[model samples]
Target: MSDPVTFALTVLALLLGAAVLTALFSGAKALTSVAHVPLVIACGLSALLAIFLVSKVAGADTPQFVSAPVTWFAAGKFAANFTIAVDPLSAMMLAMITFIATFIAVFSSGYMRGEHGEPDAGYVRYFAVMSLFVFCMCGLVLANNFLLLVGFWEGVGLCSYLLVGYYYDKPSAAAAARKAFLVTRLGDTGFLLGIMLLWKLGGWHTDLTALFDHIAKNPPPTEQITAACLLLFCGAVGKSAQFPLYVWLPDAMEGPTPVSALIHAATMVTAGVYLVARCAPLFALAPDAQAVVAWAGGITALLAAFIALAQTDLKRVLAYSTVSQLGFMFLALGTLGAVSPVFAVVAAMFHLFTHAFFKALLFLASGSVMHAMGNVIDMRRFGGLRTVMPTTHLTFLCGAAALAGLPLLSGFWSKDLVLESLQFGAHSGHPHAGSFYLLMLVAMLTAGLTAFYTFRAYFLTFWGPTVVPEEAGHHAHESPSVMTVPLIVLAAGALFVGIVAEPFTHWFSGFVGRTPSIGLAAKLAGAAEVAHHFNWGIAGVSTLLAVGGVALAYMAYGAGGPERVPVPLAGVFALSRNKLYVDEVYEGAFVKPAEWLAVMARVFDLLLDSVSRVIAAVPRLVGVAVRPIQNGLVQFYALSMALGLAVFLSFVVFRAGR
Candidate 1:
């Protein structure tokens, strides 16, 4: 009963209890309100526990805590156990999840309140699901073994499906939930296969620590390791909304804004990034798999950024931005892993840490704006909101700046580290240098695009004449203190989290396990040196790109610019607006074929039914033909028997003659 273990289990219990209480009281108003008390208390306690664990981890040189394993089940050479492990990485993630979730819960208390300031009927359900989601994310982060990780991974996915379709009566919301589930399920399938492969390789050992140690001591074949890594990364791709499987995320905006914030910022989306970082040891053995991850991330970053540029819905624009930002994280992981495994893992986790704060702020701020505009998220319909919602505007601007990677903001430090990693990879003379160089160029371009769309949404929403739609009524005002306070807190983080980038990186290096190679370690040290020195050339270029993007946005959408531009590049605009027709392409390729298959299946089903009917008719026909033979009259039976006997005798005589 160590303090750390006690605290960890206590946190888990509190969250589980919160979820259960809310579920139980969902139908009773007074009881539901009482239930929320425990929910908030659980959130607060979890945050405090997270802080304690993070402090303990950061203060110690060797920060590892593992609970005594409790066997859940056992079989020959195979067993599942319940265990919790906390190290620097998991500690940091736990801190971030609980902390952000606390604020979101507090903010939701206001945002989800009824018109008269009472809790809504569904409020209890929302908090219940939210609490459950927190528990699942914690489980995923703190799991000592891959089995628990996968279980919690699916748990979070299920919670997301429930939360996203919270408004089940809304057709769009229901459809979005299904889409998210099905799309991510595709990746989970690959993840499951990878797990099985690893389990077999390790002789049924699935404990992550033991598994990694085995792989490091006796490295598997290149082909096997590469295949496993690729399969595992497929889950990351879908969960994090990478290329090909990213269609679900944009549509997921149909959920409540708090759910969006949670998904994008603190919980579900981040699970993928965490998964890759957690398995950095396995990936280090497979360079080919790392390269695939790098390319997929780079391309997704560019593609999603371009798509964001033409989006009009405020939340949808941010939704695409999240996809692009996630791509950058993977790019960092991929490039750096190939050249410098330790730094790559650190850099990826760093970006994930910083992204949670700013992205959450942005989404919540958008929710505020939507509230004032009669729930209208279309940027084309509203303008000049700064005067009415100054707090929201300022907070959103801060978040937007950070997202754009403007110098000195949280995004700049982490994103610059990623870009510098790519540069180092290209120069490291690795076999993958050419691809690394190409990816670096793509990442840099995506940086500029990121800036453009972020500010584009900002300018169009807050600048120009105040054009509140008539349908919204006359009173557009600042959100209540409950909502505004979270914005302020998150805005401060967005502004200052970059300041600790160096120390954070150094600290993170200690937690990602051992370096795979001395050569790789040397390269990583060099990358760290470059980052420490703050390469002015790289910073200057990135800052210029960011500023140039903002300037271009201002020119096009600022007060003096045309309210509606009549651009001549209609085709390009159309393509960007249509998300480069990726959805359409998927519809044609996968959806249509599946539909055709379904139709063919139906035809086969019908034909089988018809054949079954024909087969069934023979029994009925025989029964009908023999119906009169079963009459209960004794005389009739005797007469029929006599006639049958006579006929039988005639047949016998004829047969004998023949």
Candidate 2:
């Protein structure tokens, strides 16, 4: 009986209200102490509401009424509206985001507590910002118009800045926050310009559904369309941390692990994937743009996977893994010219859904490891923790296996779809079929890299002799129930969600394909028919790659071997370990130049200030010369007047003589 719009709004209200209330009482110790309680409740209800909305949309034969348009503002030809809209795509995002956030909130209750089981100083602030993040992400997916979506996009960015810098006193955390903000803004700038271009091309319609209809009715030039879509994707490149823009995500680990889990898995980073998928109609018209996306994603996947292989920091490995997995999603999306846009988007989103679970599990599990190791995440610092932290080890194993794309797990099912999409693209007889084939090869290689690094981190941390780091003292133990329970729940999702949303039945694809924009795009492109079936051969190949990588990892590290570089491969290992010098390149190439410019600007400012001071000195000199006449003393004033009269008489006599 609940209206989709109302339910969506209610969920947003609950989260936003939680943020407001918590912030209002942040000074009250009693209230601040239990901030996570309100967050859990709000997020729990949000999950329920999201579920209701998803079911309602999934069951509807036609597009359900999500919102009634209300104009918020109007310019000469463009307008922005305050409207909520939900298609199957947004509904699925809503369900996944809210559910994952609920459990994360529960985990934070224990994770944010100080070492003595007391609420930390920023406990309230953390929950408040977290609540705001969920609210922004929900708004982003549900907004009916591009302008509204962009607003929420930046809102989430702000929330990330706050949460990532929760430990503001630490230089690293503060720098990470700034890096995340500034780097993503680089993409956001492109995104905003792309939207403006779209608006102009589509008769100035800002509403998504309307804009798509307008563009289709009167298609713009192919070159313009390509430019707009590519520009928009530039935003995705920045926000999603693709290739050249991916440096900030690894450093983002400077924040609390819970925040890292939320941003990397469930919220901020996923926004880019969601944005691209949301605009599938626009992308379908731009094959060149799609090819760029495919190439960029492919390179990013392989690049990040390679870097992850040599990382000793457990969270950093996972961070690079997150980047690689995101590349897989982009790769699926990039198959537009060779595959149905609807199919491509559905495949991409399916991976997004499945990846969220295990990635969150991996991150939270790492947090558990950090907890037991006295906050040290370095793999070489301690080993053989299988017995010391049994529950953590088990949960982390589940997550690692899932991330490695082991058969029958969530990752396996979704990864198979990604590979299948690429395979289909390569043979689709499109002009770019050869390029698609090349990307498929890169993707397969990346898969092996993914599996290798994931389990490499796993084995190094949990499979060695029970060596506890000095940081852990002698009391290393499993995390508290509050944390482990979420792990169990998330681990279950990571293990089974793919099957539950199985592709064979077209359950996941059908639900997402029902998204109105996707349907509109398919109709516009004349590719309305769904043709993909599960490819056993693709599945077999991917499974082999995953298994091969895992085997290699076991041979290298499963026996608790010392971390060492082979003499011949030392050069390779060093390159990967140094993250291919991407950061160093940026430092020398971008950061240093920018820093020098800032220094130059500072010098310019000081010179201008000195010039102004010199100019002002003239006035001061004039004042000093006239000061004797203006003195407050009566005698000084009279003497000055008499002297002035004498000078006036002398001047008159001199003039007469002349």
Predicted structure 2, TM vs. truth = 0.94
Write down the lDDT that model 2 would get.
0.88
Backbone Cα, N, C clashes tallied per candidate? 0, 2
| C-alpha lDDT score of every prediction, in listed order | 0.83, 0.88
Best by lDDT: 2
In the range 91-173, model 1's lDDT, one tens digit per residue, is 78888888888888877888887555777668788888988999999989989888888999999999999988999999999
Q: Write down the worst ten-residue block by lDDT for model 2.
A: 523-532
Q: Distance (Å) between predicted and true CA of 471, model 1? A: 3.6
- For model 1, the superposed segments whose C-alpha errors exceed 4 Å read 33-35, 501-532, 560-562, 566-569, 631-658
**TM-scores for the candidates:** 0.93, 0.94
